[model samples]
Target: MKARDRDDEGRARSARPRDGLGRPLPYGAPGVGRQPEGVVRRPAETVAEAQRLLDDGMPFHAHEVFEDAWKSGPAVEAPLWRGLAQLAVGLTHAARGNTVGGARLLRRGAVGLAGVDPAHGIDVAALVRWARELADRVEAGAVVDAAREAPVLGGGGRGRRLE
Candidate 1:
């Protein structure tokens, strides 16, 4: 079969590219574009915004916010933001029913948070613990309610209105 053709099982081939985690890229989607590492049009200036996105059940958007911080913030703080972004993406995967991917990203995010200080406006330790627990549950085939389980950004503070 041709690369663009269906497989032997007759499954249609995907035309979109995939990210590192195998999530299909929504090319041509509104507000979507190819960004280089450390580049974003508007980075989240505070964890509160990221939290609001998560509480609103937009983990994918939350990931972008975190990614912007990771890429554009101080070098010393990159890992923490990157880890948070990964966790958000993991939640997004879980919400979409990709358990394995969710678990993997959760674990990775948890590990990335190791040795980070919590003074960066977020509770790093608590977030890591939550990520690990979520990862375990996902690995065991639990269905995650992303909104109900969304992480409280900025030291467990209240997030903005939910979606």
Candidate 2:
């Protein structure tokens, strides 16, 4: 194909998928890197994907994906995804210097996650701690730090890094 065929109004057609990440998926592959059909997508998978997006600095996308899963998954697992998604969104906002939004979202996420069991992949205590810290900082009018505190896996705060 000629260069002109790849261009629309002088802008070259992107060879990559719309995600900032490079590469176009092959035929039948999902657009966002994960296929949505027939696969058993647990809340853990949704949270993990959300974490990846957050790490890539795409908080909004992360929140959206988790929200989708939270709405459709089992009730026992929905809060986990919802809470985590909000947490990521809050962090994104904080990174962007929006302390108020960050605090609000974080606290809301924590509230949404309260009383949920960790076995369901929801770390309620850690989330509550994170929310409290953020809320305190926001209340004191402290600057939002771009660095995110990592989530711990297991009761002893060991085993694996959640983010």
Candidate 3:
């Protein structure tokens, strides 16, 4: 095995460490690296799958799902998915106590989602509203409970398809 590769314990010596929010830290830093495989772009066929991940307190994982869609879905829908991913990452940051970063990402995500069509299986207006509100709160230094404030994809009722 190479020096930077995983050892018998399955730990990669050269893996970039990450903080609780799943953001990569400096190499050789004192923190655990998130499992790399979970970020693979599978491109969820339905928004419900991503919603479930968010509801389950795994926004970072949900971000990966949205990211997959952004990377592989229809070209026109990339912005929507990218926005969702940013929203998820913002929530992740909030949960990890990075209020400033959380607010910034939430605002950016809201901006990205602002112009998405509502008929595209997501309530774009509602999402943008929620994101903006969350961003404001985070910016005001509010301690957000991620689980309680987790955004639901495709709205609350009637599941929506991504394709």
Error of 3 at 36 (Å): 7.7
Tell me the TM-score of model 3.
0.72
TM per prediction: 0.70, 0.60, 0.72
Give the Å error, residue 131, model 3.
0.6
Residue 155 lDDT in candidate 1: 47
In order, candidate lDDTs are 0.73, 0.60, 0.74
- lDDT by residue for model 1 (19-123), tens: 422357775433422223334433335476667667766677778778888877779888888898999999989878899989999999999998998755577
* Tens digits of lDDT, candidate 3, 1-163: 6466575688765567765456678877887434344343434354766777667666787787787777777788788889999999999898788988898999999998887877446778888888888888888888876666787666553222222
Clashing pairs in 2: none
What tens digits encode model 2's per-residue C-alpha lDDT throughout 32-126?
54323223457566656655555555555666776787777777777777787787677666656677887888888888778877754546777
Candidate 1 matches the true fold with a TM-score of: 0.70
List clash counts for every candidate, in order.
0, 0, 0
User: What lDDT does candidate 3 reach at residue 80?
Assistant: 87
Clashes of 2: 0
